[model samples]
Target: MKPSNTIKELLDILNSNRIGGVPVVDDKGQLVGMVSDGDVLRYLAPKPLGIAGLVYIIEEQ
Candidate 1:
């Protein structure tokens, strides 16, 4: 996937297929980066409540 992909397109691919992450590639398909579900959350969601969600956040890790 190119860095130019829209958020909607990335989410669509993950949601529709129930995936965790997608490898970002260039014209040659060489791995460049990864877009994970966590990365999406980190974008759409606000920063963790350091104290309140601490347990949940730690558990997630």
Candidate 2:
């Protein structure tokens, strides 16, 4: 997978391939790193103070 690929794209690949993770590559196709399902979930998960941050943002808006 490329670094610029979206989460949906990666998830699709993982699901279709029945894999747990994927290797992230650059434009040149060199392996840069790997991303697992856990990593993606963690990234998408809410932060500890997410509600407070959302409240502040709503008030600001």
Candidate 3:
């Protein structure tokens, strides 16, 4: 699929469905990347990648 797909369309399909993120795939359904609400928000946020803020990753004990 292409990025030209609207967020509204994605949300409509995502509703009543359970998945972590939307797999951005080529026409053959091969995954290119994923797009979750979290992914979108992160990109929109005022922070650089791999930088820590209110959220941080913790190694499992």
- By lDDT, the best candidate is 2
Per-residue lDDT of 3 in model 3? 65
Model 2: which residue pairs collide? none
What root-mean-square deviation over C-alphas does model 1 reach?
5.9
lDDT of each: 0.78, 0.79, 0.61
lDDT of 2 by residue, 1-61 (tens): 9999988898899889999999999988899999998676666555654667656643652
Identify the runs in model 2 with alpha carbons over 4 angstroms from their true place. 46-61
- Per-residue lDDT value at 61 in model 3: 8
Ranking by TM-score: 2, 1, 3
Candidate 3 deviant stretches above 4 angstroms: 43-61
Clashes of 2: 0
Please list all clashing residue pairs in model 1, or write none if there are none.
none
Candidate 3, 6-35: lDDT as tens digits? 865766656547654677887777888878
Ranking by lDDT: 2, 1, 3
lDDT of 1: 0.78
TM-score against native, each model: 0.70, 0.70, 0.50
RMSD of each: 5.9, 7.3, 8.1
